[model samples]
Target: MLERWSRGLKGLGNWTAGVMDAFYGALGTPGKYLQDFLNGSWLGHPLHPVLTDVVVGGFTMLIILDLVSLIFGANFRDPSLIILGLTTLAGIATILSGLTDFKDTATGDERNVTTLHGYTNVASILIYAIAFFVRLGGSETTGQILAIIGYLVISVGAFIGGHVVFKYGYMVNHNAFSRGRRAKEFTPIMPAVELAENTPTKAALGPTALVLVRRGDVVYALKETCSHAGGPLSEGQLQGGAIVCPWHASHFRLSDGAVVHGPAHTRQVAYRARIQAGQVEVEGPVG
Candidate 1:
């Protein structure tokens, strides 16, 4: 049922893509920096969810305050209006940050889910904005009714947002399932002779995939999967000392797999690599 609804929303992606692209193009390099900040590149987690909490909490409190005013003869109008204003501001911030992150979603299904999630929140915020103005215009009962309606709309939006994250696994760290424990000793991956100089090559140790890059005598290794979106890092391009994910252009340092830029907040899992005998042996997360 929800899947059908999400699929129905897929057309929104096509309609909004050009608009988002225009917005992105206008911002350029500064916008990239702003996107990184909104994506939580500095915080090592998503910022959208955090801001959503503030909006949701504020609205919840507003509902409680309204209920108190209705039940008891208390005049909580001032506080209720204040909460509404703050929550609306937070909702706007949440929408901005969410759209920044949404611009990076690659797949149709993900975009479809996000389209519904985005518009639902937008609608909820609009309702709240209307309620705020209505209250300011001195209509207490009408404003309270609109506030209740806004809360209900936001609740539906919240549910859809959760579906995007939990069901679709959007914005999840791609490396979260891996234990992240370092190999106790060096394990041979492939013959050193096969590893081309300055090339991103894929190898594996048991179930874990690795990307190996050779620079002179040293070989740098990181998890083959991108932390942001499970993009194949071995298929990516090297820039200076970092490798750029081909899918979303996230840059991770080749030496330690530290995130140099994002859409990707968590660092890729790094490994220690050395040539032993005729084979390339890799171990550790390199501290």
Candidate 2:
């Protein structure tokens, strides 16, 4: 029964995700503007994830306050009220930030997972909002109940949020896990001439994709994809040994795929090139 229920829940999440994806994708610039904010380009990190922690953390602090009040037999009325007010505003912010992030998400499993997260979050926030109002409207006895209910709702939302990030690897660097443990070990397995002078040939090293280029006699291999958004860097134009992304113009040096322009601050993984027997091979990023 439990397994069945879990499966059902996932199904529901997927269903909702599909709907939300269509909903957001239609929003256009309104969605893009929101996505930028959620991605935290302003803060240099994902704002939705960060803001989520803040909102959830605020509620957790409420639990601590409750405990302290219970133990110290102190009047936490004013303080609890203040905290509850802040929590309301924070919850609002989390919802807005989440909407922004949702806009930029591609239309697929991620969109589905995000939708599930959104529904859970929205439900939990509404619960917390009511709890907040009940606490504000009623006396000490009712305040305690409201606080407990608010905690339960917040806890549920937090668990779903964790599932979204950890299980799905949201906001994580796409290539962070691409590098296997052997990434630092650089040894060329093939000859430089094996790859066409200007054309790049791909070789898999551990898990990373290596794109090779040859200039006269010097051969070099760098990560195959753009560090910015996974554009094929090898397919990009070559300028002074640097590969410029065909999609967004992000450039990386052929010697080492170090960033040469904006938007992509991360370096492309570079590897050593060599020849073994008749097959030319390269040692690229690990993983």
Candidate 3:
């Protein structure tokens, strides 16, 4: 049903990937910083949804105001125009942030779904922009009709975007489901001798997988799954005091598993590690 329709939109992903790659490639490190900001790494949550709420709310109000002006004969033009202008601005911001998040999406259903979600929103924004201009030209009836049309398109776009998150788990915290089950006591994972200094090594405590790194006598352990996209942290490279996710290059500090850089807004679950006899025992979600 819906899955079939989403699959039909997969071609949009293929068509946009190369263009987005070139655009971001040209920007380099600054682009990554921009992405981090847009992804809300600083705020420890995604920014796209915040802006989306504003756009959706504004448009919803615009529809209400337009309806009042039509049916009740009240003068709501000024307020409606103001809401439209603000919503259009929010829509532009939403596009920027959404694309920034989308840049890191893996190929297949996630990418395909995000592609359709993005372009649909873009179409809605364009329509709203045109409606804004039409309203400014004193054609209230035509502008209202265009705005209603835009709202309908954006509603469809919002549904697809919801599918991307609620269904496919795009931009979801990989560790969300595991938060309550963190080690409550020190659990032996591996032999202390087996963990090499500065090397990312995989170990497990009960059902929880962990990545351990030794720095002299100190052993640092964090959840093996990258919080961003579940990339195995054991396979990632250490940069100074941080572990870099192999999948998206998100850097989580080894000391406390704080995200030093990201597309990942959530912190990796950290653990306390120690050598009890010859075995390395780890516990926590120290972060």
Supply the global lDDT for candidate 3: 0.88
Compared with the true structure, the alpha-carbon lDDT of candidate 2 equals: 0.64
lDDT of 3 by residue, 1-287 (tens): 45656678777777676666677779998877887899899888899999999999999999999888889999998988999998999999999889888878888878877888899999999999999999999999899999989999999999999988998788889999885247779878788888888899998887888899998889998899999988999999999999999988999999899989988999989888888898898877775
- lDDT per model vs. reference: 0.89, 0.64, 0.88
**Better TM-score candidate (1, 2):** 1
lDDT of 2 at 130: 73
What lDDT score is found at residue 269 in candidate 2?
73
Give candidate 1's total backbone clashes: 0
Q: Given candidate 3, what's the lDDT at residue 247?
A: 88
TM-score of 1: 0.94
Write the residue-wise lDDT of candidate 2 on 1-287 in tens digits: 22233443565655554554576568865754444455564454567777777877877777788788889987777777788788778888888777655544444565566666676678767766776777777666676676677677667667766776777665544566664325444455455445787776665565566677776656677777665567776677887868877765556777766655523446677776655554555654522
- What residue pairs clash in candidate 1, if any at all? none
Give TM-scores for every candidate, taking all chains together and pairing residue i with residue i.
0.94, 0.59, 0.94
